[model samples]
Target: MSLLPHLHRLPSRVILASASPRKRELLSSLLSPLPALVKGINLEIIPSTFAENLSKDGKTAAAYARLTASAKGKEVFDRCCGEKDKAVLVISADTVVESPAGDVLEKPSNKQHATSMMQQLSGEWHAVHTGVCLMLQSSSGNMIETTFSTTTKVRFAQLSPEVIDAYTDTVEPYDKAGGYGIQTAGLGGSLVEEISGCYFNVVGFPIRSFVQALIELLDKVKDKDDS
Candidate 1:
């Protein structure tokens, strides 16, 4: 049985609390062998005032990712908790790029910003962190939340000004966290040196880690029911 069928067998429905196209594609691929059973809640990514604050513990990348995902999950859960559905599981995720210099690079806003980010990332190894949150509405309508995160090390080949300009001209780097998409034709194979971890994590979602986390959460929920 596929992932969706396995999930459907549970006593509730699965809800993805995000509006990202990449995440939707990843989830569809993961659930392809089963009947489509998951739904998505389109939630906006609000600018959090706390997003810019670096964690004093030095885990800035992981900390911001978790906080962002948790905020999104909670927002969606708050809106859907009163439903009569047997169970509603909401998944929210956030991804960020951390430079070796310890600076966090968010999505670029324009061509100039993209150019600047590309300059900083050129010939450097950076870390990509994605935080995932799973929130479930219990049979009794109470919400329970669990969070986990994954990090991938990525290295970019040295890029010339011409190449960066060419890439930025065609691709919409403004929508991507690092001013480049590792899955896109122009960027993935040609510009990236290598990846030390999950490739999908760099694309926007970390499917393998996410699946593991989801299964673990489900197991815990089942154990509670058994007890």
Candidate 2:
């Protein structure tokens, strides 16, 4: 059975609650092939306002990502779920890099910081953890929320100080988690030697895991409606 048809049955306004262009493009690429099914989906892009300041204290890398993702989803869900007659579904995600030393590396603050982050990653195996959250609000105001995290083990090729310095001089590192994007065409792409898990997760969104979760969530909603 085609999943598109199952997705078409969802009578909800779908929202991508993040401003990351990578994520938006990734999702649009997924749905672009299904014109009929895409038409049926009322999709909107609304960036969440949640401060990504949650501490990773007492939490694993996956848990931290999940927590941040849930907060982002909830922020947008509360703002958009005003219409009682229409169901609303909000999707949000967060990505973080865990260094070999058990440090959670976020986007770098400056070139020096970017250089430092890249240096830490050079010739080292790091974990890229992406957390995804789905917030579903039925027409009756009942809500269902699901959050999960996936980690991709990425190993950086051995880099010299000059190589790291050259890459950090560019504008790519500041906006990306871990001061590097594995999918970037520039030096960033050359940084990674291999990854052991979902490639999309490192890019920002875990589409495969997300589709499974979305289908399962929709099934739950269908069952709830039937009952």
Candidate 3:
């Protein structure tokens, strides 16, 4: 079933709680392909300032991703609640890279940090985890929340120190997790020889999993509506 029918019935807008261009572009692309499903649906881009202060501790990588995504979603959802008009649906997500040895890697702080991350990833396998959260409030004030995480395993092609240093100098790794972006047209994609799961997950959002979650979320409320 398509989310359009359900989404169209509600007098609400979809808000994405992120400022990253990649995320905004991806979200727009995801919805654009289904024009009939999302036509006339208001799209709001609201970036959240929620600090990612969640420490590693004993929490697993997926757990951390979900925690951060939930926090971000709630942060934005609360902000939208102040409005008096239509309902709101807020979407949020967080991504991280986990080493074969189980260490979680977030965005590198500096060039040196990115250099270290590349060194650890050279010729090794790492898992990318993305947590996604969807919170929706109907026009009548009914609310629903859904959360999930997806994992993708990526194997790096053996990279030399020179390559890592040169790539870091290009200024792409600092803002991305694991000090690299899987979508880098040349520099980044060349480093990973293969990946095991959803390709989009490594790009910071799991498109396939997200679609399924949305359907299930709407389906639940859909059932209630039918009853």
Candidate 4:
């Protein structure tokens, strides 16, 4: 019985392997609602140093996302998993916007590029891919790794030129994929007509899936402890 409940309050600190503020915010929000007992476990923000220059020419959205996340997780784990007394869970993620024409949209170079991306997204559906990797060093000194990806379909609501230009002028689109960020709330909600998948995936991470994986990992750790 104690083992079952122990899954909820992980002793290991959660390490977020991303420099993106949005990812940091979203991952922190997920753990914020845990019981007060687990509050003592800190969330470590460690950005991955892996270069994201992978080629997306022939890869599916999921494959690309998974590759990027896996590399990032491995990079961070190598650095932090060396000499930790408690366990460590490293979470890494990468996102890309897939256009209707089967093209991948990364962050824009400038306002003009963002505006161009917005124009292509006008009144069309695009897929948002988020590759999430979780690697953990258990309390008993066991290392585990897993990776997955989530995709959300997003449709823009026929943006006029003025609207595209206006949104691009803001600093938000410059660092976001497909010239928009759904987590931006006000600005992104206006341009989006519909979304048909995980909302947080469009932001950077997937909440539901991550929680499920974490629970599974915690249960496994508990089992190992009991043995």
Candidate 5:
């Protein structure tokens, strides 16, 4: 009666095209009761040249997230289709924090960079945007990609220089976007004041939206097979 039993009967395998441990953990929750239903594939995270233009008009945080996720999915789909695995499903995602000043804070490179990012986020409200893409390879070897994005309004508490420096010394901020991990030490729930949207989105993945999308995708494939 579990979802995994049904998913196992599908025609293709589900592959997560990301190297992020956070993503791997989140996706694992989706493929539950079916051991190893999701496999992680390390795909390059570089966006295409076209993706850079997605925010040319300075769109909302949600728009930018969706666009980035779609781009990453397409990139991975192109690479996977070239192989013999014609009926594979690839999931890709990207997360970014948009500062009030309109700058996108990505993963920081070092302690100094992380400290600077934390300082900018201190005592302010910022937007967390996460874009998720689902790419499925058809029987005809055609790849179809669908994308969606989620936005969470996060408000951080005012941090003294000592607090920022203390948090930076921990490992929790280095591997996450905007140099902070919301689920753990990223100040989302513990130190953050408020959030306006999906809680999981700030943690890294939007669980509700992601599950709904997966179900819809599977239904489409089922209908096609029935025909």
Candidate 6:
């Protein structure tokens, strides 16, 4: 059955609080299964200004990511809700790579940083976590928020210094978390020896999980309307 009708019936002003092209592409593709879903959506790509400098000390990777995502979502939700007179749904996400030794690895600060990150990941299994937040506000001023996370286990093939240098030299490693992108063809994708979970999670968003969560949230909103 087509879900577009239901999607359209809900709060139509949906916002994606991210500037990452990969995420934007993933989300647009996620809704593309339903013809015209992309066209129907009032999606606004407003990047969040939240400082993601939250300390990772004593927090699990999932918790850290989830918190960061929630903060980002809340920042955008507040801003959008203030401007729009209708109900708004804001989606935000944050992805991070956790080294085998348990250190959280975010985007590299420099070329040397990228090289070091590659060295840490080479021949080792690491966890990639993507945290998501959904903030929905009804026109009546009611607000609902949910947050969840997905983790993928990825193992990198043993890499020589030359290989690391070759990868870091390209533009692939700087913008992406973990200093690599699993979706990047030939270069970044070649780093992973194997992955134990959703491949899309490593790419930055978990579409399956997001779909399920959105359905559940929509149902709740529908019930409120019917009541």
Candidate with best TM-score: 2
For every candidate structure, what is the RMSD over all alpha carbons to the true structure, in angstroms? 4.0, 1.9, 2.2, 2.9, 4.4, 2.1
**lDDT of candidate 6?**
0.86
Ten contiguous residues with the weakest lDDT in model 6: 31-40
Per-model TM-score versus the true fold:
0.83, 0.93, 0.91, 0.89, 0.78, 0.92
Residue-by-residue lDDT tens digits, candidate 6, 134-171? 88767665666789999999999999999999999999
What does candidate 4 score on TM? 0.89
Residue 183, candidate 4: C-alpha displacement in angstroms: 2.6
lDDT of 3 by residue, 98-210 (tens): 98789999999988888888989999989999999998666655577898999999999999888998999987897888888889878788899999998988888888788
> Model 3's lDDT to the true fold?
0.82
TM-score, prediction 5: 0.78
Candidate 2 lDDT, tens digit per residue, 105-186? Answer: 9899999899889888999999999999987767766667889998999999999998988898899999999998888866
Go through the candidates in order and give each one's C-alpha lDDT: 0.74, 0.85, 0.82, 0.81, 0.72, 0.86
**Model 2 CA RMSD to the hidden true structure, in angstroms:** 1.9
The digit string of per-residue lDDT tens for model 4 on 1-227 reads: 12234444565577888889988887666666466655534678888999888888789877998999999988888887655635778889999998888788889999888888888889999999998898777777766677888899999999898888888888888778777888666897789999999998888888887777777777676677678
lDDT value, residue 82 of candidate 6 = 58
Ranking by TM-score: 2, 6, 3, 4, 1, 5
Residue 131 error, candidate 4, Å: 0.7
For model 5, give the 10-residue run with minimal summed lDDT: 40-49
Off by over 4 Å in 2: 36-42, 82-85
lDDT for each residue of candidate 5 in 98-180, tens digit (9 for 90 to 100): 87676787778788998998888898999898989887765655555578887889988888898888887877677787888
Better of 3 and 5 by TM-score: 3
The 10-residue segment of model 1 with minimum total lDDT is 40-49
What is model 4's C-alpha RMSD?
Answer: 2.9
> Number of the top candidate by lDDT?
6
lDDT-better candidate, 5 vs 6: 6
